[model samples]
Target chain A: MSEFLGLYPYWVVIFLMMTGFYIVISRGNLIKKVIGLNIFQSSVFLLYISIGKVSGATAPITAEGFEVYGNPLPSVLILTAIVVGVATTSVALALVVRIREAYNTIEEDEIKDEIRTQGAGP
Target chain B: MTPSTDLLTALILTLLVGTAVAVVRMRGLFPALMLMGIFSLLGASWMLVLDAPDVAFTEAAVGAGVSTILGLTALALTARRAKTSSRKPWPALVIVTITGAALVYGMSDAPGVGDPAAPASKYPVPSYVERTDHDIHIPNVVTAVLASYRGFDTLGETVVIFTAGIAVLALIGGVAVSVRNTGPAGGRAGDGQGGDQPDELARGVEPAA
Candidate 1:
C-alpha cells in the first residue's frame, strides 16, 4: 500500500483528466461544467509536480549552501501553464457572461432553441 | 526487498482501475469533473515515479490546469446534466481499447523501468550532462530542451497568446463595462435583474434578485 501511495498521484491525475473530460463533454449546467474542467487541468499540475520530485534531493535552487537539488524544470513549466490557465479561465468567464446576455439562459439546449427561434421567421 | 513495494503496486493498480471505472460510469458532469481532477493528481504522481518531473509538471499544468478550466468554461455556457443518447459510444470505446492494447504490446520492446543503461540516459542525457558547461549553463535538461532545442516553438506559442488577446478585445468590444442599475428603457425591470446577474456572479454566487 505504501509503495502504491507513491504512485497514487499518477493514476489520480489520469482519472481526474478522464472524469473532467467526460463532465465537460456531457454536462448540462454551465458552471458545473467549468468546475469539471478545473479538476481536469489540476490533475495535469499534479503530474508535473510528481515528475519533479526526487527521493532525497532538496529544492532546485543553487544558493551558496545548496548541495543536492531536485529538478527545477517541472516548476518552470508549471509556472507558464498557470499563467495561461488563468488567462483562459478569465476569457471563458467573459464569454459566459456574453452568452447569458444574448440568450438569457445558461442552458445549452435553451440557447440553441433561442437561436433556432431567432433564425426562423418571427 | 520489502512488502511495501508490493502493496504500493497493488494500490496503484486498484486506483488505476477504480479511476477508469468511475470516469466511465459517471453520468453527472460535476462528479465526473471532480473525478477527473483526482485522475490528474494520480497521473502526476505516476510521472514522479518515472523520474520525469518536467513531463509531469507540463501534464499537470496544461492537462489539469488549463485544459480543465477551458473545458469547464465551455461547459458553463451550456448545460450541467448529461443525457445518454440511444446511439452507443462504441466507436470511441473500440479505438481506446485498440490503442491501449497496442501500447501495452509495444512496451515489450522498451527498456525495463528504472534501467540505468536505458538509451534515454545513455544517449542524449550523458551528452547534455557533459557538454552543458560549454553549450548552455542551465543544469536542467528539460529547460535545455524547451529554451534551446524548441525555442522557435515557444516563440510561436507566445504569438498565439498575443493574437488571442487581440481577437478577444476586438470581438468583445473591449473591456467589460460596469453593469448599471438602470433598466433597458429608463427604469426598474432591467435595473432589478439586468445589473444583478453579473453582480451576483462577480460576488461569487450570491443569489440574484
Candidate 2:
C-alpha cells in the first residue's frame, strides 16, 4: 500500500498520457488535437518533475541550514520544454487558421473530401 | 513525504485527471477550451507540489495564459462546435490501449519517487547543486543552471520561439490586413477574391478557387 502511495503519481501521468494520445488519434477537430498534444506534453513535464523531486527536500534555493535540495536540472530542462511547447502550439494554431482559410473547413475528413472533389491526388 | 502532503498530491492528481477526461469528453469547443485552461492550471499546481517552482511558473504563464488565448483566436478563425466524425473509433482505441499497456510495463522499472539513487539525483545534479553557490551566487539554482550552465541550450530555445513568433506574425498578419481591407459591408465577397490572395501568398500556396 505504501509502495502504491509512493508511485501513484506516475500511474496518473501514464493515464493522462494515454488520454492525450487517444484524443489526438480519434478527435477530428484540429484545435482539439492541439489541446490533446498539449496534454501529452504536459504529462511528460510532470513525469520529469516527479523524477526530480527528493523527499524531505525544499526548493533549490541556497540558504542557511538547508542541506537537501530537489534536483534543479529537471526543472531547468522543463522550463525550456514548456517554452518550446508554447511556441510549437502557436505555430500549429497558425497552421490551423491557414487551413481553415484555404479549405473552408477544419474537419479532417471534409478537408480530404474537398481535396478529392478538386481531383487532387493523394 | 508526509501523509498530509501525500493526500494533497493525490487530491490534486485526481482533479487533474478528471479535468483531462472532461476536456476530452466535452463536445462544445468553447467549454473544452476553457477546460484545457483549467487543466493547465492544475498541472501548474501539481508542479508546485512536486517542488519545481520554475516549471510551475512557466506552466501557469504559458499553458494557462498564452496557449488558451491562442486557441481561442484560432477557434474564432474557424467554427465553434467541432464537426462530429462518423468514423468508428475502434482502431484508435486499440492503438491507445496497446501504447498504454506498453507504457505501464515500462513504468515498473522506473525508480520510485524521491529515490536518492535515481540517476537524475546522482552525477551532474549533485554537481550542479554543489557548484551553484560558488559559480553563480544566485539563490535559485534552477535559474542559475538555466541561464548560465545551459545558456546555449536556452539560447537555442529562444531562437526557436522567436522563429515561431515570426511565423505566426506572418500568417495571422495577412488575415488581419485582409479583414481591415474589406470592412464589414464587403463581407463574403471580399473574402472570396483578393482578400484570400494575401493569405495564399503568405502560405506560399495557391488559393483553391
Candidate 3:
C-alpha cells in the first residue's frame, strides 16, 4: 500500500540502527564492534539526510531553472558527521591495536580473562 | 519523486540493510570490513538520490575511503578472524526488536520524505537559497552556508580532527608503543612479548609524552 511505502525510509533507517546496535552489544570481537559503530553512526547520517530531502528539488546549487532545493543545513551537518565518524573509527582501531599488544586478544571475554589473571599478580 | 529515483533509493536501501546484516553475521574480519565499506558506498549513493551531493561526496571520500583504509590497517595489526562469541543472542535480539518497533511507530508523526511543507523547508529565515545569491553570491548554496554561515562549526571540526591525529600518533605512530617493552629490565613476564612486534612497526623514536 502507498501508506506503507511512504514510511519505507523510516523503517529501513530503524532496521539499520537496530542491526548496528545489536552487533555492538552481542558481538565479542573488538573489530566487529568498531564496524558496528560505523554502521550505527551511518544510520544517523541517513536519518539527517532523509529529513533534509525536499521533493522534486535539485542539489542545493542555485541555478536559473531550479525553483527549490533540498535542505543544505542537513547536508552540512552530515558532512561534519561523516568526517567525525572517520576520526572516531581510526582512533578506535588504534586503541584496538594497543589492546591487542597488551592483552594479546581482541575478544571481549578473553580480554576480561586476561584482566582477571593479571589482577591476581603483584 | 520520479519512478527512477524511487527505484534507485529502494534498491540502495535494500543493499545497505543486507550489507549491515552480513557484517553482523560474518566471522571473517576482512570480509566484514569490506561489507562495511560497501555499506558506506551504498549510503553515499542514496545521499545522492536524496539530492545531497555535498554529503555524498564527503561520505564517499571519508566514509568509504579513509575508514576502510584505517580498518584494513588495523586489521593487519590485529586478529584477522573473529572468535565465536560465548554469549547468547536472545537478549540482544529482543532488545533490538522492541526498540525498532517503537521507533517505527513513533515515525508516524514525521513528515513524509521530501514533503515541501516540512518545517525544514520554511525556517532559517532568509533561507540559504535566497541569501546565497543576494548576499554571498555563491552558485553552490551548500558551500556558502557551510563555509560562511557555519564557519565556526567547521573550524571546530578541524580542531577535533587534529586532536584525533595526535591520538593516533601517540597510540601507534611512533616509539611510544614500542618503548613499553624496550629494556630487558622492563616490567614482568607479559611485557617482553611486545618487543617482537612487526618490523615496520618497530621504531626507536623518542618515547611519546
Across residues B1-209, which tens digit of lDDT does each residue of candidate 2 receive? 78887888899999999998998888877898898899899999988988899899899998999989988877766767777788788999899889988887888778898887888888787788888889988789999999999999999999999999999998778876764564543555447776754453323221222
Assess each model's interface with DockQ, reporting 2 decimals per model.
Answer: 0.16, 0.78, 0.76
Candidate 1 lDDT: 0.53
What would the per-residue lDDT of candidate 3 be over residues B41-125, giving only the tens digit for each residue? 9999999999999999889888888898999888767767888898999999999999888988888778899999998778982
What TM value does model 3 have?
A: 0.88
lDDT values for all models: 0.53, 0.85, 0.84
| Cα lDDT, model 3, residue A29 | 92
Q: List where candidate 2 sits over 4 angstroms from the true fold.
A: A1-5, B186-209
Determine which window of 10 residues in candidate 1 chain B has minimal summed lDDT.
B200-209
What is candidate 1's lDDT per residue for B1-209, written digit by digit as tens?
A: 13663456357546755875676566665566566566665665555454556656665666556656655544443344455434345554555456445534443354433334544434444454345445777666557656776677567657767766765555344324323322233344336777544433333222122
- Residue B39 accuracy (lDDT) in model 3: 95
Instruction: Give the TM-scores of the predictions, in the order they appear.
Output: 0.55, 0.90, 0.88
Error of 2 at A4 (Å): 5.6
- Better model by TM-score: candidate 2 vs candidate 3: 2
Q: Which candidate ranks first by DockQ, i.e. highest?
A: 2
The deviation in Å at residue A93 for candidate 3 is 0.8
For residue A28, model 1's alpha carbon misses the true position, in angstroms, by 11
